[model samples]
Target: MTAALTVSIVVPILNEADNLPKLFEHLHQLTAKPQQIIIVDGGSIDGSFTLAQSLMTEMITIQQSAIDWQVLASSAGRALQMNRGAALASGDVLLFLHADTKLPNQAMTEIALAITQAKWGRFDVHLDSNKLLLKLVGSMINLRSRLSGIATGDQAIFVRRRIFEQLGGYPNQALMEDVEISKRLKAIGKPACLTSKVITSARRWQQHGTWHTILLMWRLRFDYWRGVSPDSLKRHYYNT
Candidate 1:
């Protein structure tokens, strides 16, 4: 078997105290561990930074592994926080993960193989919900991403460190940073589109009503494509 790539997982967070424990547990259970895990907090007031620091300390002490775990504070924006984490990474590949998502078993091994074939890639995403419609939603999302070569952040996007830095990392926008970066990367080549799925929270759909959330996302993407500024879209997204 080929040696796995050195992967660094960068997770950007804001008020994710409730989800941090489970995310850490998932990391501990990975079939092939990452070289490091960086958690960048966006000035969360919910004690998220402290919790992340505590978890990192405990994980390091218990595992006694060489994995570098860092908890950093950044301005309150997903794009900015992710960029900060990426800047500190020291691995061959960087995987931007969401706190509410859980990678499947063998994710690191799968990514290692995928990276050999493409400069960047993303895993298929499965929404964690029992609703039949939500299951269909997840399937459609995966199919759409596969056909379009555009990845959403929830899919666990991974890329070669060199290429990522060359592209100047994610655009410092309030929204659609994933889509923007995917377009830039696709200009070089299509994404690997791995079959392994990352399970992500369905909280948005649950909170907003599945159909409503789906329609909102489609509308947002259409508006974004039509050249609507991310600042304008952000207000609509958060219903501000």
Candidate 2:
């Protein structure tokens, strides 16, 4: 019999203690468990790493679950943290996830199936907000990613381990590393474009104002595509 493919869910986080508990709850309930859950901490002062480790210990004590979780420290950058996590992963596939995003119950199963057909892909996303504009934004993001072969980090990008290594993982960028990687991957093949949505926190949009965030994102993308350096864009992103 053929061995089943194993997946490593790699999450890069910084100061996300508030989101870790809910993230772990969804992860532990996954129907198709990953071979390992690698959390790469980017110098969080908020005890996020301790919280993650404690949760794993709790899972083992309470349910006797074999929780294969690794918490590693790295430089404070999402791309750097993820690359570190990917290096330590021992699975056939790598799933890059955001700390504040919650996967659907069937996400692991869907990802396992999708990876068989395509080397890389991302799930659709639903923002956690009742605002109609947020709903529309989510729909547009899904549709745009499907049609343009590009994906945002909130969508939960996954890739074959070998392919990821060949692509050199995410670029060393201060921002828009997701977009940069998507462009490179699309050159090789179209993504699986899974329709099932992963629910992500709408806090960014909510905090910045929906319309304003939307316009800002578009401008960032345009600037990135027009040859603006990620460092310059990163400064602009945080300054605004």
Give all TM-scores, in the order shown: 0.98, 0.96
Summarize candidate 1's per-residue lDDT along 114-186 as a digit string, tens digits. Answer: 8888999999988998889999999999999999999999999999999999999999999999999999999
Q: List ranges where model 2 is wrong by over 4 Å.
A: 1-3, 63-65
lDDT against the true structure, per candidate, is 0.94, 0.90
Candidate 1 Cα misplacement greater than 4 A, ranges: 1-4
Which predicted model would earn the best TM-score? Answer: 1
Per-residue lDDT of model 2, residues 145-214, tens digit only? 9889999999999999999999999999999999999999999899999999999999989998999999
Q: List the residue pairs that clash in candidate 1.
A: none
Q: For candidate 2, what is the TM-score?
A: 0.96
Q: How does candidate 1 score on lDDT?
A: 0.94
